[model samples]
Target: MTARTDGGAAAEPSSGTGRSSSVRRTGRWQGVAAVALLAVAIGVLAKRPPLLLVGAVAGAYTAYPRLTATSDPDLSVRREIDPASPADGERVSVRTTITNEGDAPIADVRIVDGVPAMLSVSDGSPRCATSLLPGGEATISYELRARPGRHVFQPVTALCRDASGSVEVETSIAAASAFECEAAVPDVPLRAPSGHHPGPLVTDEGGEGLEFHSVEEYQRGDPASRIDWRRYARTGELTSMTFRTERLAEVVVCVDARPESYRAADATEPHAVALAADAAGRIGDALFDANHRVGLAGFGRRVCVLPTRGGRDHAGRFHRRLATDPAFGLNPPEPARAAEREGGGAPPRSVTGDGRNGDGADADGTVSIDAQLSRIRAEIGADTQVVLISPLCDDEASRIAQRFESGGTAVTVVSPDVTTAETAGGRLARLERSHRLSGLRNAGVPVVDWTPDQPLGAAMTAIGGRSR
Candidate 1:
């Protein structure tokens, strides 16, 4: 943001505080010198004592005029910034103005504008030093580097001091301005063929794709390349060939933001749950823009699902919700000792009601893990593609994925591996991690091992390749 000063000329001080202070100090010192000189003159000239006293008094009075010198200046400051939404690593210009608001003439004025922490000044400082009389103003300008996310403007500090620096007043003015630097996401073409699916579902509506659908009698609007020469030669009827519709796919991005997924392997912005949310947002946008139906779902203690929809509006809604979602680790299973490792054995038949195993059943004879998966599978249609986003640290998650895949659902695992040494230990821990991953992959589930250090688009590209 830039700064500037406005107005011109100095104004007289209504209050004499500045003049009074100067007079008081100068008069006292002059009075002392006069008394000493009067005594010396009386000694030197007993006959000229009257004349010496008059000279001493005259000298003291001369100091009074000097005390009357004072300057009362009125000063104000303003700042401005341009192109608030700058891309990361780009430069933005800042402008400022300083104005004389009071009657007194400010000998020296210094103004400083506060900059958000994310941005760094690239050229010149936000601070400006100058002199301004009442009604006089000055303008200052500079530049800064912008970073990603929202950045707020800080208050501007102004220091007004006299030429002698004996008297000074500090004032701060509020500036309600900010700049946003947004990061860029890679735009990859969506490959799904069904235009009905949410997102940028690519279609054969005059776009790139490979599929033949029908042929119609050629009209004036028909493209030359679409003219079916074989039909024209056989029956002497000109025809235009139409291709099959090829659009983006419908993708349901399910994020496990339950308290269980918040654990992180390292300190990073958007911990485990947040990372998953961000990745989901980026992938959802790409798919939606490619003309696919995209839906958002968050599962934890409670499940929040945004019905599948296609369009830019839906994409924005998903992002806003994800940004504000709660941040907490998933709840541990009740009766910690009863926590069953995923894929170790079938969960108790009572909890799941599948009659698969007896050991892991809950008190009510319910298979807790599989039951949840069953509900999820029921909610989504058999043909719909499900992308499960989570930091799969336990066996239940693996089992859930396995069940979904086994139930004829195409499952793509976006695993935000958040476990660190502090949570998992030794060879046993490593083996368990490997086992759970293997179980899902073996079930024909495409897995994306996403970490916090990499961009989420990278993971999606890898998954897209596998899907193709």
Candidate 2:
């Protein structure tokens, strides 16, 4: 059975087709009755038979709308997608065929296929308008470029109007449509220290690894491969080479879904919260591939925390939650606020014992960062590093990062560049964002300044070099 996704509960298919229909009055012919009355009055006052005929014609037109009967439009929608499992950044072509199953002819019909929000249309249109007779069909084709993550198509909307255009039957056609694309590991460098696990993170402690750390006098049972043969030959004594110890790390990929991070550089682009959520999924996948324990969290009006775990199953569940969970869904927490820095010139709030800044909330309903951080600390291990994805649009976001770092939690801030310079306010916000990032870096926190236009891997690589 085809699945329904209309921002509500799935509709059960009836008559072997998933369709739900509703009717509404368009009010297109409401003023025609008044015109007919006026014409009849003119004919009576002027005593002209021609005016009377005009009144009769107006009356007929007015009655035509009321006389026209439109049945519930029964539509069967079938969607065909080319290259069903598309690679990231691959263009996908979709064709939707809509068939009218009702006995009455639909004079005017409009159909709009559901397109996933994360996938942008690269070519063609998903909408079509035409007339459909009994058993007649219409088709619409569109192309969308795929991105990382699983995307589900919403239900198609079809509007059928009667011949008089006075009534409209709106139908939502459901079809099974969804695709999952795995994202490549970003290979983001971790400046934070690692947990005690054998993996790829290099540490100062000498152990098994390719990169040399130091050499010491050879001890009994030292691996022959690690023995410094040249040093032994020169000094007539044995020495052993010690390479940097590589251990895996437990990482929590946290996204800032607060209302302030919902800003987008332009209307066409996804908001910062959406971009951050996507980045968090990629980072979490990377850590998981390296056999490191990965946890997920979102800090905002509603905080969502998943405890640290390592495995393919955990990664799959983590990625799916990021895509479908209400806390991390594409929808913003609140209306997009102006991308201005936080108001009230005050030093960043320190981590208080009670996990509240003064009273835990402000008069404006803004929750204290300390409370949120406290929740995170309670769930994570002491060695767990936090990969914070935020827009850094407001000072409070920076404060959250700094607080996490100061509280002895390893924190890496990934700030997506969502500030545009199209207006004076945008320019000022961009300047302020720059200073905030710089301040975070100076405070000894590793910061990745990411622009949505650039590949995330490239940004991570750049920041990795800088941190090294």
Candidate 3:
């Protein structure tokens, strides 16, 4: 949470006393001069009364009000943001209400609402300028370019000045409020699976997966078709068919949220790590809706690994994890010797650890990319498909994809390529990006090169089509 206080002016008693003393001293001197002039004028007025009148005018000017003005603008602002689920690049409206609870009327009131770094102002402005009377209320509305994850709002400022203009005061509203707007994940409808588990799992009843595994003596309410005619003929008794138990596929989505991979090429932009997390959430939701088990794992500075489970509760868990995870830079760990052995294109040497180095042994230090992929593969069944979401910035990610393929687990990569040829800084950066793209393609990994400048779904579809 971020807070700031500004714009209240306090009058020092010593300073005020000193100023009053000076004024009093000057007034006494002027009074003495006026008395002297008045005495001289009284003597001269014996001959002329006009001079005595001038002395009285001067004395009246000295006795006029010596007014000192000071204003204190005490403002309090509270904001409540709603509709916490907004999609990437989507427009979200933020409503801010300002109340003047102070005694002074605030003039030239300008407010700056703190927006999330990931969000951009694509349409309306976040700053507002207005005037508020005491006990009056003002409302401001603006649109923000929503990005995935939680964002905090900053405090509102109030500027007020006194009527005399001699004193000016700026005050920040106390009791500031904050609300989080979670960006929604984009999802594509999933195709229904062919099999099911019979005990409490959702499925299309009477399907091919429901096979008759046993038969028992027929009882009341048994369907005629379920009756075993052969058993009835042999034993002269009616029997009912029992179906086999059905089970749904359990899916676990493991996302790479390490600091190195989290940062975008343009540091000002939304991090790729957040994008990958959004995609994972979308996929997880789709699977959950289909009655398939879904799980989430975020590997970064602090690993947030969740166990695989099914139902609406699990989906909520996954969403919460994705919304609060911290963003990391795009550096991945070094590749293993096995990655080199199973060759495709030469891996780039630019990739390195995110400041903190990982030990060669998986248990001794942080889990390397290879070990994580292996662990994920081992946890799921052979038929389970592992959807790896990453920016593909390093050799380790490619190696993991290859390992998953070789391990008989179907691997589909959703690569969010933050690199752009239009503004790659220099020729060297552009060349490096080209080489990385080539290497990823050579590995036969289904790569989705998503750019911040374009729509993610369209880019992924284009890549998916070309791969086919």
Point to the candidate with the largest TM-score: 2
Report the C-alpha displacement of residue 134, candidate 2, in angstroms. 2.8
Kindly give the stretch of ten consecutive residues in candidate 2 with the minimal lDDT sum: 345-354
Model 1 scores a C-alpha lDDT of 0.57
Question: Which whole-number lDDT from 0 to 100 does residue 78 have in model 3?
Answer: 42
Provide the lDDT at 1 for model 1: 19
147 in model 1: Cα distance from truth in Å? 9.7
* Ten-residue stretch with the least lDDT total in model 3: 15-24
Give the whole-model CA lDDT for all candidates, comma-separated.
Answer: 0.57, 0.75, 0.53
Inter-residue clash pairs, candidate 2: none
- Candidate 2 accuracy as lDDT: 0.75
Worst 10 residues of 1 by lDDT: 15-24
Candidate 1 local lDDT, residue 11:
12
lDDT of candidate 1 at residue 174, scale 0 to 100: 42
Runs of candidate 3 with Cα error greater than 4 angstroms are 1-77, 80-114, 123-142, 146-249, 265-267, 325-378, 426-438, 452-455, 460-468
Ranking by TM-score: 2, 3, 1
